[model samples]
Target: MPARAHKRFVLSDQPKKPVATAGGTFRGDAASFYLPDFCDSRAAFAIVLIAELTAIVLSIARQSAAVGFWGELARAALFLLWVGLVSAALLCWLRPRLARLGVGPGSVAALALLTLVVAAISACVSLLGHSRLVASAGTGAYFPRQLWPFVARNTVIGFVISAVALRYFYVTYQWRRNIEMRAAARVHALQARIRPHFLFNSMNTIASLTRSDPALAEQAVQDLADLFRASLSDRHQTITLAEELSIARTYQRVEQLRLGERLRVHWDVRGLPPDARVPGLMLQPLLENAIYHGIEPRPQGGTVTVTGERTAQLISLVVRNPLGERQAEREGNRVALANIRERLALLYGARALVKAGRFDEEYIVTLRFPYIASAPPAGGTRPAHAAPGSPEQ
Candidate 1:
């Protein structure tokens, strides 16, 4: 069946202006200063558990056989829980503002807030206990003797515990950030590997077409420009599914200009949600690999079949092309598969999947990733090169 076009690609026809390279550096700095998202349920639960464990340990250290020991333990647990929840809530609220600060300043602010919360809670608890002691003993003398000592001890303990916790958090954040940077570097490297080949081949095609078909050559040049523009974009962000498909279409058209009728494509993407967010340049590389390894080697090229479908939670895309000779399946094919697989895993964690192999007489590559809805085009309009019902090709 003929695929139905969605407004997504039409809207993306005018790609966002090329962003400056410094944008990435700025993003990195902002991200590095961000405190952990304390509002997250998992993070909140972790804080609660750690606070409870610390309370238990401290209570145990002071344990005695007296029945009042149980009361003390209970009070300690309740106090710690209150302190933990309050700190978490305050941090969650301050995270955005803190992220804007320099790393050193942000850390100091977070630590200060934590200490303040703990001290305030401890002071309240100590004052209440001192009042009760004074009331029962029928003498105000105990307040001066015990209140300050109790508050000081608890405040010092809270500061130590909070400092230790912050230290651990900083270490963990650094570790995770390093891992993310490594993955991003690897992805960029892989993306770089593909670009030179594409650039050289595309330039050569445009160069050859200049003499015979100047108009067609100009169009090819424009398509090549579009491809490179998308290539230079932020790979970490997602584009609309339609935009991704449009990029693939541009890549295919460029190949068709070079290979003529031999490079055929049939797209069955009616089932796809046009506004679904997908990693940028995701679909084009597969088509490029298909053309490079599958169609380019044979004297008579083959058709590349693309089909897409969306489930409630996932979106799947399948690319099929006639299998080339075993010798034609060289390093390029393997590199493309590995690059795509790694990119998907990095973006979607375990939820993304890539499967490739020969099925019957055709080579097939299937990709599956979680469905991500995109917001409506801003101002109720986006750049459009075609009508909503226009054929994708």
Candidate 2:
């Protein structure tokens, strides 16, 4: 919990990308839908097995043939199915908190209590509905007594499950931390590739104009300073879409200083959720890909367009660049898209994803992820990602 809170603290002031504040909620990508292996089916199945066996044992001990083998198994199966359904439903809300280790022992105990309540409700149904079968088998009177032991056993089982869940939380934290470190390293490498090369590229552009336009050369140097600083700031992994776009826009401005009449950028943002989130430094890398692979190769650079939208369940984003002449699939040099996709998978599970491809004359990449946001207060629309210009401070 401390670790998770610390992480939140670290990212507290970062910029928020496009998002919608539903009520007072701070909504973003569904990457928060990730859940680890704490909830195991085998364990749940075992709980049902014990409960039904207890019921059957009591029925037979009372000389009642009502709760036969199949009947007992059926009852157990139903109870467990109830548990599964309830947990699955709760996951939609609980998943985000769990991803960041926000769930604690108390939360686990509360869930246990809820499960127990459901269990009791199921017990009442069984008792009332099957009274005749139970009575004829001489087990009706002892059924309540049989329930006590299962209840007790189940309570202990719940505790065990909670303990396992805590362990899984720790394990997941470790796993996620490892992934973050690797991504940070990769981003660091990419930043290096950008700056030295980008600086040199800009310097060369300035050098070409130094003889004819000294004032423009000086302005280029200043733009280059702002560009490098903006490009290689804190080196964190996640950022709001707004922060990334802010940096991207700044970087593009710097590029314009160098590429005068060739580069163009347009935004098609009609579909943005207004509170979407994305990896920090994500856009810059892809933008670099656009500049280097597409624009640099062509003497007359093309346009880069960014589009974002939201469906009922997911946030969708696509970046399109118009520079695909030959289009031989360079299948292997796809680390940026690959790493980003991997991170999204680990963060969002299967619900959030990204895909990059090329068609006839354009290279495009798209991202789809579940939309998760902080809960909103009463009587308010969804909130923005955060304050702008306070760009991920």
Candidate 3:
């Protein structure tokens, strides 16, 4: 059967733009969300420099009323120029240099170097322009002391900004990782639902043939052993559909051996991507439910058909058994369907799905997942397997 496709991958946990001051977490400050203080330090520095220049212009205007507007306008123009030059040099120039600087660390060294460069650029251009403009304005003379103090004030602001920005980002990262770990753990716990039903069923099947056919009985025992071995291996908890199917087919063979022709099986398997993943032993219990509730009850015998197909962007897997009016009274079968649906939700969040109902005369269970033809290990560069060619548009 082909795998079902779903589109849950487009959703992301991170926000579009980082928030300042209160940090970027959607979680509120009332609950202790990490503060975006690191960039706040840099942002504070930027704000401080602008404030100092504004003050200087204000002071100049008071002394020479005619040049007030000119002083304010000049500061504004100079600040704009300072920002353009620093942004270009930091984002374009300094960042590329850091790559070669062998500054082996988180991009912190690049950020620090960029901050220092901005401070230098802002300090030089603003101070020089302030001095020349003040001297020419004729309201008062430009003094080194005056310009240096403002430059020093803004530089300190820049360093503070750096510290605040780093802190917020660092904490945000830690927060996200912890959430993912906890979520993964919860899903793993739900996986324990793979119960002893399969084991007991296998033993029962073997016992039915123990005296009737010794050779077939021996083969059933071996098959049951292999299925249990594969299922119980701690390292084998999660397996691809191909692997899971292999195990299921083995178990199904054991069932076939005991039940003989009374148990009919039909596979309408197509379109499944071999690289697709599934919960370990995800299908066995559902199959078992079909056998116990659908096949065994039919005195004349019937066929169980399993189908997998791609439905638009999602992968859909459906198991249909010969069920007619009997479906109305099959309480045990309904429980199996509910259990599988809960497991899908717990395992894949909203990405996975399950359903059970009557389609005409057949009782069916369908499951769907966002199709990832080939999904490698998370963050790893490997690819998932899909159909030989690309999927239909």
TM-score of each: 0.54, 0.46, 0.47
Q: What is the lDDT of residue 255 in candidate 3?
A: 72
After superposition, candidate 3 runs with Cα above 4 Å error: 1-201, 208-211, 233-236, 311-313, 324-339, 342-348, 373-393
The positional error of residue 329 in candidate 1, measured at the CA in angstroms, is 6.2
Q: Which sequence of candidate numbers ranks them by lDDT, best first?
A: 1, 3, 2
For candidate 1, write residues 1-393 as lDDT tens digits: 001111221221222212111102323243555468888999999978987887788678876444345665776678889999999999888887887775567778888888888788878766765676657876443222465676677678778877887777766765665477556656653554445776788889889889988998999999988888888776767777888888888888888877888889999887787777677777887888777777887788889999988777788999988877664545666666656655665555445667777778787888888876678767885443222322221
Off by over 4 Å in 1: 1-178, 181-195, 327-330, 383-393
Question: How far off is residue 238 in model 3, in Å?
Answer: 2.7
Give the best candidate by lDDT: 1
Q: What is the lDDT of residue 379 in candidate 3?
A: 81
lDDT of 2 by residue, 47-117 (tens): 45655665565445544355665665555556655654555445544555544543343346445654565
Which model is ahead, 1 or 3, in terms of lDDT?
A: 1
Query: What range of 10 consecutive residues in model 3 has the weakest lDDT sum?
Result: 1-10
Best by TM-score: 1
- How many steric clashes does model 1 contain? 0
Models sorted by TM-score, best on top: 1, 3, 2
Model 2 superposed RMSD (Cα): 15.1
- Give one digit per residue, the lDDT tens place, for model 3 in 1-393: 112212222122323322111111232222222322223357456545664665566566555444455565565445644553454345443433443432234246745664676567666755665575766876342322365666676567656755665565556755664565445544543454334665676678777678877788798888888777775664324566666566667767877865678888886655775556676666766677677667877887678887777667777788888784365666555555544444454345456766676677777888887665445568864332233323574
lDDT of 2 at 32: 30
